[model samples]
Target: MAHSSTASDKDPLYLEAHDDDDERRNLCGTFWKRLGFVGVAVVIGVVSVLGLSIGLGLGLGLRHRDHVKFTTPAIVTVPLQSSPPSNFVLNGLKGQPPQTRVYAFNVSNALGAPDGVVRPMLVVNGMFPGPTIEANQGDRIIINVTNNMDVPTSIHWHGLFQNQTNFYDGTSGITECGIPPGQFLVYKFGRFLTFTFGEFSGTTWWHAPHESYRCAHTFTDYSTQYADGITGALIVHPSEPSPPDFPTWDQDLVVQMNDWYHTFSSQLSAAYLSPFGIDGTAGDEPVPESGTLNGLGQYGQGGNYFNFTLEPNKTYRLRLINSGSFASIRFSIDNHPLTVIEAEGTLVKPYTVSGVTIAVAQRYSVLIHTNQTVQQDGTFWMRANIQTDMFTYVVWGQNTDVRGILRYSTAPNLAAVPVAADDPGPGMSWVGDMDTSLLVPAVVDSPPERTRMYLVVVALENTADGRFLAFMNRTSWEPLSGTTSLLLVREAGLERHNATSFAPVGGSLQDGDQFYVTEDSIQVVDLLINNLDDGDHPFHLHGFRPWV
Candidate 1:
């Protein structure tokens, strides 16, 4: 949502560090803290910082136990298909015991031209956008990621609750030391739902996943690495039909969209982070040169449009993921109304809309009945347009309207050019949509009867040297060098540090971006986010689902 506030807070059991202004007072009541920042800000209310160390130890123990040994499977060589097959559904997986899947990925540099202009990009297993990780709920997924590139990197399993396997979170500096260049790290975790009603059932993703690091372009690097390529879809099927009777689809297809940048991610980050932001404008995020659907788009240079062929009359579930580094996308198809069913990972009551405006790192699964009569050309334009207004400055030749083809099997001319439909005008977006009540969670898991509320402000600030920096109240997050906070704290022992705060933990709060909790009991928190900045920023919790 643009220029509006949202109330979404993470689970209190697993709290990330952030600075707070209050002390241990009123152990049984609600509290509010005012924090301001320019970009995205995390509102964390910690009752016990010791959980971080405990979680990390549990995760490490799970991976290194003498009894648990993993035999690496052969890495798939073929380029990952853009969408899953028609038969990829959960019905077949029911009644089977959970199985473990092991995968190995080689992270390296390569040249790709999704828009017909080749550029150096980071890739997994020699492919852009990596590979899809498909698994049913409750399956253990062990991935061995080897760094073949010159730089060290880590892969954050976005949205997957690490639970007891917190060390496998893949967050560099916070959870574990990054996989150094030429070295590999094994990420072992289970794909389990966090809530009663299949909380993490639908579409999710995995990316470079960085919280703030010390480098100027590190923020961009988080965006850049994934933007360059290392992004992929992660589909977790529900053990049973979510909400018991929610309708199922005949075909499950993934439509991954991203705003494409021709320039190197590092250069773009440097310019955006620099004092003179791209033409003297401070804090202007680098606008993408083009947008891509399923990693392909016909833009300035020339490229193939992602095509989706379907059998008529069958209900298809389109797992839409906005894996772009920046820029929220508005997705729709000509003459097709999308019936929204899932947001991020939570399944919602079916609501139909012309289009869906998906923010970065957000996912939505919508069902579309392919009942449209076969047209002359057999095709309808699938549009994944980037919201240009979200950008501070406009690029002259930028192609915001990224299109693909949705062809029916009964069309007369499969080769004929498809006619574009009239403008849909800015359709319904989760953020800007007026009818917020329409997309209610299928199962309403109410928050605790008594909860703590925190007020946080988000804004951008210009440093003395001219660099633009984001802050929440008094501090900005910068990663601890050499070792991760979790590892450092675990090695130093939780007994040495106060359970409530990281202040006594040396080098943990030097950046002053994190806060801690002194209590051990489970507590509910309400994080009220007020976006003071100009654009629509998306905030994500690495390991837990936030009740909105």
Candidate 2:
């Protein structure tokens, strides 16, 4: 009985106590709390790392945006020196009025903004577009070209025929190497004959001759160094300063369209990106701006704005010139009719149109009657939007960038329109096949004062870099030659020649004049054309349209 009690009677109280102790034990509570604290610390460290990464990313993004905003376009001033002589007197012919006087000056290249920056330029009468020269039909013109810059230069009469007076053609090699720097040359020619059909008053332009190549080559980095900013207009009025018989407006606006290439850095990186190539081809470079009116750049807010005053009912003559190296412009006055009267200095039968397309070297003189109310603000815009197959090689295709304003005055007593008797209808189109017989008839018996021949030679040679090198009359203009001794040697040699024999010189022209025959009795002026595997050069003549 004692042995059995030893196994079963092993204290029920002790077993109960053991069970109670097991039930009261807090086994993993402390461990769980410690683990939770560790987890919280790890989470805080990860969150801090993420916040710093986000902050750094935001700061970098803002800095990049600010840098882009700071690179804004700026206004560049180009120094344009004046043409040398202050005054010139052109001689007269037999039975003609006395020689007319013309002022000569230069427009130098100013290197900064339009408001300041002064550079040497060759201008007539100290104006960019030379002063309008008005004369009777038979009056003679005397132009004394004075070179005041550090380079040699010449003046071309644009459309006037040299006939026997080839020396005054204004072409450096053709007439004579333009007067050297600090030198002077005089050009005298007469218009003793009357036109049979062409109108007396029209639009035209004038520019520096081949000698301008000196500047052209020197400033090749700047697209418009020699041609764009350096050029001007030449308005040859039919008669003296008598008010027009037609209704006239209070102001006459002459808008000269031009292209410019400015330097963003001293290294000419901006010019290097120019879209318009030096020889009129497409390049990978950038073109900050294209066309402008009155020397205003095409970018920036209100940088190139032109404002004009107009009465309620008066006619205004808008003379437009397509002075760019390439691109024809489509000009129009929004909500107004344009009555075109002339083209390229030749009057045409009037015609009306909503807009007109003007080709390179072409001029248009339109008479617009602003009869609308003052509330109707009008815009006279010139856009180069016409699609042409000719611009296959041009970059960005065809686009115009010139515009101006034609605002009607709010003034109470508006200007009165002249009688309709003098207001000619829309003029004829100058784009048709020109009827030679209809042009100014050849002076039947009047002996030619001078006769000269111009041979236009174009060459496009392959360059070492696989690009084509273009040249006028076989002379590849070397941009680097500006600071070289070759330029001075050429200038000194050109100065030694007789000024009279200056007609027809330069590269192949010089060689031709030396090797080709010059007969005295030829009547008609001949312009021989030869394309030397080069690109096509659109040859232009001012004042008078050349017959093909």
Question: Which candidate wins on lDDT?
Answer: 1
For candidate 1, write residues 405-487 as lDDT tens digits.
Answer: 77776768655446765643333343233144577989897755444555555556677887766655334544555455554
Task: Please estimate how well model 1 matches the true structure, expressed as its whole-model Cα lDDT.
Answer: 0.58
Q: Quote each prediction's TM-score.
A: 0.77, 0.54
Top candidate when judged by TM-score against the true structure:
1
How far does residue 102 in candidate 1 sit from its true spot (Å)? Answer: 1.8
lDDT of 2: 0.38
lDDT of 1 at 166: 54
